[model samples]
Target: MNQELDSAAGSLPHDNFRCGTVALAGRPNVGKSTLLNALIGFRLSITSPRPQTTRHRILGINTSEAGQIMYVDTPGLHRGAKRAMNRSLNRAARSAISDVDLVVQVIEAGRWTDEDEALYAALVEQSSPRLLVINKVDLNKDKTVMLPFVAELVAKHSYDEIHYVSALKGQGLQELEQAILQRLPVRPPVFGEDEVTDRSERFLAAEMVREQLMLRLDQELPYATTVEIEQFNDRPDGIAEIHAIIWVERAGQKAIVIGNGGAQLKAIGTGARRHMERMFERKVFLKLWVKVREGWVDDENMLKKFGYTD
Candidate 1:
């Protein structure tokens, strides 16, 4: 894995500078990944419209003159997780918030569901300072309507601070950042100034391919699929050579992923390769294969092998 910091290492952390880890906790489809990317000023975590798209605890680092904030983007804490993989996701999400310096509960503006309430209950048990981030505020044209909802919410719940912002449009983030920095303890930076994340290119490669699967596959098919990077080698020719396998539970699912005349597979490879080149900052030669791993999602050992467990 390449851990080299970029040339522009930015300003060093000065006296009284605050630094700590912050966990973006929320229910599924609440735009936590988008908020993480926006806060870091880098596309470190993959995003899709699907729920539970983030299955791992990904750390994104943002270093500035003020301080270095290590943001942990976690999987959504959802209910009714019957499968082993789903259970693992909840464990990862819960584990991430336990050790973080601050917990930011992100939810869509003007709406709060049962899942949101469930996650809030979990956050109450944590010792970290909690903040409420109302994301997707841009979607609500009638801003006045939110006052009653927020009022009712504050009446029943408690938060150190509440902020409204649209993660997609990058709105009202400066205030949120300042509030977060103020809450963190004054300490030196833990990561290099130029580092955006601790994740390696190898892990990111699998995620890029899985993002494509979540976007292109229909219905429940995406949930049954996972990506494995069989090989990720930076060739002497200056091109990243990647070999990946798309694991499905059934042969029928494998046929669908491969598609007629291999067109679907081709499209997945093309899309994932383009993202890899941009994120890796190099040309990529990607090759993909679809394989059937019967009942991998429910098998605990298989889930661990696929990097689903913490």
Candidate 2:
């Protein structure tokens, strides 16, 4: 086995091919997931209007002749350390940014919050090359202010480049891709040419369920919820069976998710199944059950069991 691996490694040739990991780091709701989906041409990371929607480091691979840019979409780094769950998310975000080829610091157009400033300040101290990106540019009414805003950003720390893009509208992504490709080191592609993400379908299924909860619930309930896939079976036929448990921190939360007579759970399940069917291009039977895991977020064992820790 050692001889065979050595032979394959010796024959490798990537003199000028560009390939490396790019970490998308930013504050909450800065559109990191949207930008990642736009660049990869697929929906790997779940997105919602809610802040801190992402809780893991999702890897999206963009393969092209220009080069392969493996983008790591991380959860937004925030100061919410009220619970062990929030600290787990923050640790995931920090770990994703380290040891990457480049860092894409996403920020909203014409807006800079305290969290953004704190994240940017930390990025400046890192050795990796960082690119300041102004996302949601199309939402800004005054286009002329972008230049000044970007200039002001440059004065803080010399970014490799500044990109203005609307991730939802698919504007200026080409330029961002070009900049990423230029900054990447010469190496062979890390993922297949046609591969979009490194995450499995089961993980995506769980995220989709959580997305549904975020979309349907209000206030702090969504944050108290997490999904666990208990059973996943691929039939010989063309259908997939999935059974998931929605973990809530309280019994009241479980009632909220279950609704008066399982109506809310059925609605969430229906939406999730439809979305999975469309994404997978096959039949998906999704089943969701709400359970009270009381104070799971603060328990390290429970957090690790649910795949929330690094």
Candidate 3:
């Protein structure tokens, strides 16, 4: 049977077969979204240094002459004090690990913590085929510094394989792609050839605005903010009109978002409009309004309305 399996793998037409799913799991700020965007050759997911930036499971698909590889970008796993939002995010992250053809556990090459070890242990206990992906290799001046640590972890955990790559710089991605494709089960393409992501345009637009706000705002401002796309329309003149609402937790928060003489809101709108125009490939007229929605994040109904829950 071993010989037959090897022979079948060798004879398989790599170009004709469709690949399978590879889930990207990690702790917050470990660059999972960056890796996804880099692999798919586009910015499908909004990335920020802020933790819990990705609240949902985002699918990024890569198609080649060989086959298609679907990568799932999950929310970062974090230890919280049993808050509803925290619990939901952790559940979303773990959900990606189960029932997937391959699991790619992304870890920061520069840091090794007990938290990483705990998560690694859980993944191992599941007996799933997995790879330890060491992201952010570009930051390491001496790449060999991580080699010994990676080897120790692999030996201790008995991982199926270890892959080292700088996801931000696109290093070692081809090899990683080959490793993923080699493990994927035989299947047909799950989506069309032209589709790069599973998220809708409205979702992307809202995320883009949220990402900009997160980048621009400091203190508690980013945490208290939520963005919703109220209207999106494309005209025959190749222009897209977008209206979005930025919700804050308090009236004071609303004032901060609007800024002195509306400076901050205008800045966020300008930045978001440039990105939206580039993404939609048309002129974007974005209208943003601020409203105070008290306790929106913790409110279950509000969370469901925002698609954080179904």
Candidate 4:
């Protein structure tokens, strides 16, 4: 596609300093998480094929000689706000674009839908500089169509720049990083150089369990399912202990998560623990329990209790 990081750093020294926030905004499943992970060179956000797999404003802090690129990886900005939870997610995504140095609007290559248009309209209302990112270019077979498609996108928004990338395979990411770095404000870094994310250990652990449920359950997934980290401890013997509760919106969904003879829960726990061990780099003991909390996604108080916005 348009593979160029020539301007991402722009004649700057290897130790040039730049640091600020860049909000990655797009529709659900548009590789926003994949792009964030690729840019940061680590897994700060969890990913699955499921829509709304990410519900929070995940930050991935990349501090280098070029300075800190503090990215705010937000959930997809969508129009369907039928549920309180859905509205909350939209709110979080919308809030990310405000008071930010740059906004990178990620869209799938060679296609534009109404949802994409809606998000574009929202960004146009904001004053922050925006870059148009056409992701998943690897999936587009006909390379010739990319030019015309990019031309059409150029007419759609007043973008400062346009980049094409394959977030999954790390194509054109160097260019993406350079483009972002050039736009970041010249200020002191906001986070520690060693820190990858602002989320705590408990928050990331809960997300790991939730990611497992989405991957394993498939169609049996609950609309309002979440993981609560009841206990997280690191023993002196080099074992990490974690107890997480899977909260579902319905009793039947809870049963489905647990599966027949508790086999499903066990399988899900196994998958989650493997990921946990890899993230923590230690032997992990993960305990999971399922509970049904009907209509909790719609209740403001319950939403707050689960670390969700009302």
Candidate 5:
């Protein structure tokens, strides 16, 4: 691995440089967001066990002495009856594949199914330069058993390379990162050397809240919930004030988010605030409010207003 890194390092130009985008594409809940966070060394994208937690194309920038890699984390693709929001999310995910220099197709280590094949087919049809990334390897009891199958699949699909990584455990990620950097097109860095992600602090705050909601809520409630940051204020004392609204599709869903006498909401707030403080490395005062936005998923105006539209 050191030799490989040395070879890649030698291949790169000597001057400060930036590379193009690398898109993370896969089915829902396959650890795409987690992998992006690992690659960038920060949580630029929100992650949960719930499918489709990532609804937008989030860019995570990694700057090093070698170059910069802008990782685009998109919503997971799924087959279903089309709703306005679903269509938008799918479109955003698919669109990332076309323009990016490299596409990282994340697949669950033990959960390969027909849907993954279909996604692979669609991805292949685009003729994009791609890599097969088998995620969640840490959860596998027999990693060697899956490698041959992954190798065959990669051969069949004609992918540029294959990487097995445990995103959550940070296993085998350095290889993945080196491979990504090697494959990226050489150019000047698109963002500042200090910038990690393109998303605004408000956007990340909202996503952190939504991630907590998804983790805490049960059943369909998690799927029906969305978070929006209404206001953010930075104080002089190294603290920030954040006000956000958690919108649910129905009144019952709203009640669940608020919890029995607001216990649940408090729990969500506490979890989200802690994460915010850790990410920002400062104090965060998060104000969360529950609102019922009926049919927000289907309502075009509501979806557009919340930055969910295409």
Candidate 6:
């Protein structure tokens, strides 16, 4: 893995290669991040059972013999974004969709909510070719029932192509990839084949800790918390040492995160460190601390400081 990361052997060998950006657009909890990881064959983005798990625009690159596809996984766009952080997420999602080679609107296999309709309306305004991906098809046991749902959708809206995929099970991905490649223009690959993402290891460190928070914290507590990396250093002995702070909105939340005898914090750190070691391919020693910020979610300046703004 280290050797592949250090080499740049995958380049465009032919002039007919197709390379461009594709934004995975959708509402919350619709499997957009899952689709991205499956397509790129790398777990660049974090995932949980929570809505709005992705808060920023993440770039995952896939380079093959044929072409390189840059996949932008954006935060799920939704309505009634009243909080400053929620609005910031919406801003990131909207900004990501505006400048892309293609837009893939992902939705659940058998259901389309108002948020999906709203996103479709937004995508209709874009000049880029749009594709509708009905994800989580594995959950839909009866395939015949999807005919009418798709029939109604097509009658009311338009898409350049429609595809059904199960991102978790890796179904129907080849055809989707072919369709996406065919629509992209012929150009040289922008990134090397071995490169999986454009994000830094520091940025990914914070995300890995936050993924554990989302999975372990109860309702509403996870949304109120954000992880900040204080230090990430590679030691002389070749081990990575990291110190992180878990910022919450109130003292009560902080206590809950710390738990009785620091059990909760220990669990969170252990989970995050394991994932970091796996992804970074190194030994990771992680330390965590809980802190209160007193409504940082509503403070715009604090949001900017936390790297929420572009």
> TM-scores of the models, in the given order?
0.96, 0.94, 0.91, 0.92, 0.90, 0.96
The superposed Cα distance between candidate 5 and the true structure at residue 130, in angstroms, equals 0.7
* RMSD, one per candidate, in order: 2.0, 2.9, 6.1, 6.0, 5.6, 2.3
In angstroms, the error of model 6 at 143 is 1.8
Off by over 4 Å in 6: 1-10
lDDT of 2: 0.89
Q: Which is superior by TM-score, 2 or 4?
A: 2
Q: Estimate, for each residue in 1-310, the C-alpha lDDT of model 6 and write its tens digit.
A: 3545435634356578889999999999999999999999988899999999999889999888888899999999999999999999999998899999999999999999999998988888899999999999999889999999999999998999999999999999999999999989898777777788988899999999999999999999999999888999999998999999999999999999999999999999999999999999999999898999998999999898888984
Question: lDDT by residue for model 1 over 1-310, one digit each (tens)?
Answer: 2234422432474698889999999999999999999999988889999999999999999888888899999999999999889899999999999999999999999999999999899989999999999999999999999999999999999999999999999998999999999999998777777788878899999999999999999999999999999999989999999999999999999999999999999999999999999999999999999999999999999988888877
> Which segments of model 1 are wrong by more than 4 Å?
1-11
Runs in model 2 deviating more than 4 A are 1-15
Off-target runs (Cα >4 Å) in candidate 4 are 1-16
Q: Write the per-residue lDDT of candidate 3 for residues 1-310, one digit (tens) a residue.
A: 2555445444535545867888898888889999999998988888988877888899999977577789999888877636566666777878888867888988998687766776786687665688888898888899678778776776777667778899878998889888888788766566655668878888889988998998999966897788899999987887888999999989998998999999999999999998888887789989999999888877878877877751
For model 4, how does the per-residue alpha-carbon lDDT over 1-310 read when each residue is reduced to its tens digit?
A: 1113334333334444788899999999899999999999998798998878889999898877787888889989887688888888998998888868899999999988888899889998898889989999999999999988888878856899889899999999998888889888776666655678878888988888888888888674645688889999998998999999999998888889999999999999999898888888899999899998888889878888889861
Give the count of colliding residue pairs in each prediction. 0, 0, 0, 2, 2, 0
Global lDDT of each model?
A: 0.92, 0.89, 0.83, 0.85, 0.84, 0.92
TM-score of 6: 0.96
Q: For model 1, give the 10-residue run with minimal summed lDDT.
A: 1-10
